[model samples]
Target: MPIILLLQLSNQTGLLSLGDLLLQAATVLHEGVVQVVGSSSAFAAIKSDGSGIIWGDAAKGGDSSRVEHRLQEGVVQVVGSSSAFAAIKSDGSVFSLVSTACGGDISCFEHQLQEGVVQVVSNYLAFAAVKSDGSVITWGDAAKGGDSSRVEHRLQEGVVQVVGSSSAFAAIKSDGSIIIWGDAAHGGDISRVEHRLQEGVVQVVGSSSAFAAIKSDGSVITWGAPANGGDISRVEHRLRE
Candidate 1:
C-alpha cells in the first residue's frame, strides 16, 4: 500500500489542539487520511483503507460510534449537509449520522440506494443521489430538494451531473439542459430564465438564493431570488467575456 498523507488535519484557528493530538498519534496518522468533510459543527475523514473517522459535535454527526460497524471499511466517499454526514461505500450502499433535520436519516430512500449510486450531493437539509442508471433519488427536507415528485419524470434518467445550493438542486442532463427543484426562492425555479435554459447550458452555479447557467455561447443567465444572486443583468455584458 502507498503512504497517504494529511494536509491541514484540522482548522488552524480553533482546532489546533485536535490537530496536535492527531499529529502526535503518528501511527494512526501514518495509516493515512485521504479525505476530510465537515458540516456546520462536526468533521469526518476517510482513511486510505476505506474507513471513516469522525469528531466534533456528536449531534451533528461527529461521533461515528453508532455506525462504526458499517463505516469500518470499504467506504469511498463522504458528503456533509448543514448538520449531518453520509457515507457511500464501495458497494454503493449508504449510511448516515446525526439528526434527520440535517438529512442524517435517509430511511425514506433506502430501497433506491441499496446499490448502484455513483454520486451524492446535498443542500442545507437534503440529499440527492445519482444512480448508475442515471436516475435520481432524494431525501431529507422536502422544501430543500428532498422531494423530486414535481419533476420525477425529468430526473428518471440521462442526468450527468447534479449541483445543490443551500435550499435547491439543479441537474444538468446529458443534452446540456438543466432541471431544478427545491425552494423557489433559493434556486428551485428557473422559469425567469427558461428561454435561455432551453439548451446549451454547459454549466450551472448557485448562491444562497439563485442559480446562474453558463451557456455554450459564453452567455450567462440567472434566476431565483433577485438579491442573493439572481439578478445579474447589471453585469451581463461583462459576464459574456
Candidate 2:
C-alpha cells in the first residue's frame, strides 16, 4: 500500500484519521490477512469480511476459537494486553478474547461486561473497562494493575477517564478526583500524594512507571518511581507558576 510505504518516509506529512486507517486496513485485508498488531503480548486481525482473527501465545490471546460465534461479525475494534485480547463491538460490548492464563477467559466477568461498556484501557498485563454508569471493571495479572480491590469503592461510579503506567492505572472521576490501582511499585500507590488528588484534577499523565496529575488550579502532583518523573522535587518550586 502507498500509505504504508509513505509512512516510512523520513518526511512523512499529515496524520491519518481513525476512519482513514480503518478504510485502508479494510482494503489491505482483501487477501484474508495483512494488518497485524501486537500489545505487550498477543495479536489480532480483522479479516476481509470484517470478522476478527486471533493467533499468538494461546495463553495470552493468540487463540479465539472458544468465542468464535460472537466474533463472526461486528467486531469494530480489537486491543490486547500481555494476558488476552479484548474485542469491542458496535453496541458497546467487550469480548474477553483468549484463555485463562492472562485473563483471556472472562466467563467470570461476563455478566459485568455484558453491556454498556464505553471504553477499555490496558497496561502491560491488565485491562480496565469504563461503563456507561461510570463504573470500572478490571482483570488480568494481579501485579500489573489487574486487581483493584483496594480502591474498588471509589471506582463504583463517577469515573470519566482511565490511564495506565507499565503496571498501574489512574482514573479521573467526574468530580475531578483521582483513583488509582495496580502495582504500587509502578505508580499504583498514591498514599503520599493522595490528599492533593482529592479534587480539581483535570488530567492524569502516565509514564512507563510513574504518573503526573494536573489539577484545575494549575498545580501538579506526581508519584511512582522517582527516577521516572514521579519525584519532581527539584522543579517543585518552578511548578508553582
Candidate with best lDDT? 1
For 1-241, candidate 2 gives per-residue lDDT tens digits of 1112111112256876646654654554557653566654456776556577654455566556767787777777777776577877778888887656665656667789878988888887888999999999998787787788888999999999999998999999999999989888999889999999999999999999999999887888999999998999999987764
Cα error, residue 51 of model 2, in Å, equals 2.6
> lDDT for model 1, on a 0 to 1 scale?
0.83
**Candidate 2 residue 155 C-alpha distance from true site, Å:** 1.2
* lDDT over C-alpha atoms for residue 135 of model 2: 98
lDDT of 1 by residue, 154-206 (tens): 99999988999899999999888899999998989888777778789889888
Pairs that collide, model 1: none
Provide TM-scores for the models: 0.86, 0.80
Shift of residue 122 alpha carbon in model 2, Å: 0.9
How far does residue 196 in candidate 2 sit from its true spot (Å)?
0.6
Each candidate's lDDT (Cα)?
Answer: 0.83, 0.78
- Counting clashing residue pairs in each candidate, in order, gives 0, 2
Q: How far out, in Å, is residue 62 in model 1?
A: 1.7
CA deviation > 4 Å runs, candidate 2 = 1-36, 47-50
